[model samples]
Target: MKSLFLFFFLAVSAAIYAQSASTAIKPKPSYCNEPPEAYDSRKNASAVKPAALPKFNSKPVMEYRVQVAILRKTDPTKYPFHRSLVARYQPCEEVWIVESKQSFRNRQDAEKLRAELAKMGYGGAYITTLVGYE
Candidate 1:
């Protein structure tokens, strides 16, 4: 009787241990079993499109000469001084005096120079593009 009881107890323990081990080992799904429809090429193509160029005005381009100046103040009191200086220096017929809140003498010369000045420490300089009418 003792031997039979021992044998049954060992058999139950082995069955429980085998069930726990199998539960710990998860089975991975086989790729071959997946449906062919899951790998669709149409889905990727629909997400992308060719970029378009922006439209611009085709009007005649006018070029203007520019002069850069550093004014002492913004009030009209400063205008006469600027006007006098501009009249004295007098840029060619195409050039005009442009007033700005900030001082950037070299940058006001051209668009590229203005952009470069903005990148450097002179972002406050007001930009004026001159277009010669005459």
Candidate 2:
């Protein structure tokens, strides 16, 4: 019968496929068998002492500033300033932060500058400390 012959062929094909799959070699990964030392972090600490870094106790006093606005780019023509006033342009994290003069060591000066900047069309301006060491 044709059905019996087809069933016999399928059974033989399945047996051969199963035999090939069972005989296939599987590689043993090394990470699966970690050593006992890998489990202990304290034991693997640095054997040698690290050298001491130079001291910086006598750092200079810090100052504050008024931040006008942050944009992709700044327009110097609109936000004009003299050399005495600091209009710092910091380009960081894919944007630009335009800082009003670093001349504001006190809150009063920062507030005054922020108000002036607002009148000049920079409404969202505010005061903040300098970003990092000079």
Candidate 3:
């Protein structure tokens, strides 16, 4: 009798679960419903003109700096010009460039530093212009 009651209880539970599942609302998957005019690029191309390139201020600004050395490797601690000294790596040239930390407004100031550096071991030191930090 218990076994029959157990079977009937399972049958009723399954029917109730099935009826609830069928009545439950299911969400439908959304799709891109774009119009045919938007999909047609060629027809839209005539309506949309190409954007013009932005204009930049072409005025050139010049600054001078005394270049101490250009080497594959450099030790900042060993550099003689400890005051206001900076080193930058040139990836294209594959070299480490050592220069003055600050730019001199006048070429004469840069030349003076180059002359002093030449007196030291850095004989190849020269005055170089940094064109827009190039």
Query: Which candidate comes out best when scored by lDDT?
Result: 3
Better of 1 and 2 by TM-score: 2
Candidate 1 — which residues are off by over 4 angstroms?
Answer: 1-61, 64-70, 73-109
lDDT of 2 at 9: 100
Instruction: Give each prediction's root-mean-square deviation over alpha carbons.
Output: 29.3, 20.4, 23.2
Give the TM-score ranking, best first.
Answer: 3, 2, 1
Candidate 3 residues lying further than 4 Å off, grouped into runs, are 1-50, 73-81
Each model's lDDT comes to: 0.45, 0.62, 0.70
Candidate 3: give its CA RMSD in angstroms: 23.2
lDDT, residue 103, candidate 1: 32
Cα-based TM-score, every candidate: 0.22, 0.46, 0.49
lDDT of 1 by residue, 4-56 (tens): 99999999999999977754422334544555653334455565663555656
lDDT of 3 by residue, 12-116 (tens): 999999977864433322332343444335554776666665767675568899887776644444555546567886654556688888788788988888787
Q: What lDDT is reached at residue 22 by model 2?
A: 68
**Per-residue accuracy of model 2 over 27-86 as CA lDDT, tens digit each:** 445654665553235565687655555776564545668776565433454655534344
Which regions of candidate 2 deviate over 4 angstroms? Answer: 1-46, 59-62, 73-92, 131-134
Which residue pairs collide, candidate 2? 86-101
